[model samples]
Target: MTHGTSQSTSQSPAPTAPGAGAPSGRRPRRNKVPEVTLYFWIIKVLCTTVGETAADLLNEKAGLGLTGVSLLMSALLAVVLVVQFRTGAYRAGVYWTAVALISVVGTLISDNLTDNMGVPLETSTTVFAVVLAVVFTVWYRRERTLSIHHIDTTGREAFYWLAVLFTFALGTAAGDLVSERMDLGYWLSAVLFALAIAAVALAHRTLGLDAVGSFWIAYILTRPLGASIGDYLSQPTGDGGVGLGTVVTSALFLTVILGLVVYLAVTRKDVAPAQEAVRHAD
Candidate 1:
């Protein structure tokens, strides 16, 4: 997917001293989000790559053109999101499907603005970044927290998904901007974003940065990283890519995503326990 990301563990929830969204003595809510594990990142990257190449495949091979592809994918994304919202807790297959679809939709949104509407990549990138910042500001002011571990309520999940959508759009625009401006080949662009994410991880672990902030930053960074990887592998050799073609790249990544989703569904490795303690500590 063009844009997506999140964290490792969660703080347990509170026992309801101060009233919030729900009342006290309510049944424990399950964490809607998954654990921030290695598997999570791997699948996430696969999703981003799939989003990129798959969108290209549909647009070019399917002959739907950009507008048709955008509308079709957006409709499919809306349907998947509905199912995702209906789920009581994290289900790898459902969640990743939503993510992969959202990635495609997000990319399409940006592509439409740039390719169809004649907007510059720089303008779209800046616009999406500002919109994402405003969303984060509002989400934090209302919920007083941005941690993925505590997203048990519909409101929180809504904010989370909204953020994910913007990240994808922004990543697509910004990734294209950087790659084209610097004249850096896809491989170099990938390396650059990978290093940037590593710096975020290092900052969070060693430089006293907030975990939630670091996680979100890294999450957004991964979008561009994955996009670069997709372009590198899918574009022609003359265009400085590995020449795998969009279909091959999309299918390969999709297959990997499918395998991971099945593995997670069976093992439940990504599911984090709902923690009442985490809420209280905060």
Candidate 2:
């Protein structure tokens, strides 16, 4: 799904990092993002689950309220992103670390709005959805493509991360809203999202859904799906979870993510073919 040049056909070889276009004889770096694969989705959902539980863990255990946890995670996310942007090519450790941190920050953002600022989940969900839409609109208008395969430029990377952040925030809010209104509890909510993602995949394969659209849709759905799974595992039995607690849930998912990242790093299977580079506007 990520290999085609369906989004843009006129890409040229570009410097891998910002301001690295000097007349050096060295070869340009490869893409900074991972190629979409089964590993990518697995790690993504795991990170999303970690995001859900890790945020709660910090808020409850660190004595940092929602606001404090948000600030702390956001600072860490900023630091990791700086390091990520400075790296010229995809590094599994750096890239996945940033993703995990961002997931926590994203969940915290939604929580603060709901628990701290008294904003309703519906309003936060709507606001985040609109913000995400604006980000995509501006990104496409400026870059002319939304394909992750082409995120070699700093500008595109910025837009991509911004969209990712909002997607998490939106997903958190929407998940809470749906679970509460429908009274489906955590396991059932997880099942609902799982089925939704399956339907999206089916549509993409058989009903002519475009790759980018299918990807983003699945991406957004995974956040809530992961959140539901986390909640189901972590919350008390009376609360419809298995009572594993946030600490266990977070640690469990993080371990899986670490193992997957290590495997991907060693195998290098998620790196795209250098010849199938991202197509960017001139």
Predicted structure with the largest lDDT when compared to the true one: 2
Model 2 spans > 4 angstroms off: 1-28, 275-282
Question: Ten residues in a row with the worst lDDT in model 2?
Answer: 4-13
* TM-scores, one per candidate: 0.90, 0.89
Quote the positional error of residue 147 for candidate 2 in Å: 0.1
lDDT tens readout by residue for model 2, 1-282? 343223322342344454544222233245678888888889999999999999989998999778877888899999999998887778899999999999999999998999889999989999999999999998877666677776766777888899999989999999999998999989999999999988988887778787788888889999999999999999999988999999888989999999999998887888765533532211
- Cα displacement (angstroms), candidate 1, residue 156, comes to 0.7
lDDT of 2 at 111: 89
What TM-score does model 2 achieve against the real structure?
0.89
Residue 217's lDDT within candidate 1 is: 84
Question: What is the C-alpha lDDT profile of model 1 across 35-77, one tens digit per residue?
Answer: 8889888998888888888888998987889999999999999
Model 1 scores a C-alpha lDDT of 0.82
Lowest lDDT block of 10, candidate 1: 1-10
> Quick one: best TM-score, which candidate?
1
